[model samples]
Target: MPARVVVGVVTSDKASKTRRVELNRTVQHAKYGKFV
Candidate 1:
């Protein structure tokens, strides 16, 4: 159980970073009409 919790935390940290990057890129594209 503890191992699963630790793994979940690590996976979430990675996923959040990727999601944030994608969201930032999309917003920048919408504003500038170009890929950022």
Candidate 2:
């Protein structure tokens, strides 16, 4: 297997030598089978 690269958004950056990242993903609903 190969290493996977993930991309996300930086919601905030107000710390000393640190960063805040937000990773989002969609999951299918159990009953409706819809991805949201």
Candidate 3:
């Protein structure tokens, strides 16, 4: 499989070359089948 590309907001970029990112995704509640 090819590498998956994810786009997200950079929440923190203060720690040298490291960074923190927040990804928004929805998951279906198993039994209820509702997105969460």
Candidate 4:
């Protein structure tokens, strides 16, 4: 299998050596057949 590259955004950077990252993606539900 091959790896996938996802683009994310840095939401916060308040801590000295810590940061917050946010990634948005769409996923399909198994039973309901809906995208979430």
Q: For each candidate, give its TM-score against the true structure.
A: 0.18, 0.56, 0.61, 0.66
Q: Scored by Cα lDDT, where does model 4 land?
A: 0.94
| TM-score of candidate 4 to 2 decimals | 0.66
Cα lDDT tens digits, model 3, 1-36, are: 759777799999998989999999888999999999
Could you give candidate 4's per-residue lDDT for residues 1-36 as a string of tens digits? 659888899999999999999999999999999999
In terms of TM-score, which candidate is strongest?
A: 4
Per-residue lDDT of 1-36 in model 1, one digit per residue for the tens? 465321122223346446222122223477668856
Q: Where in model 4 is the C-alpha error above 4 Å?
A: none
Judged by lDDT relative to the true structure, which candidate is superior, 2 or 4?
4
Flag regions of model 2 displaced more than 4 Å.
27-36
- In order, the Cα lDDT scores of the candidates are 0.38, 0.90, 0.91, 0.94
Count of backbone clashes for each model?
A: 0, 0, 0, 0
Q: Would you list the clashing residue pairs of candidate 1?
A: none
Residue 13 local lDDT, model 4: 98
Model 3, which residues run further than 4 Å from truth?
A: 1-3
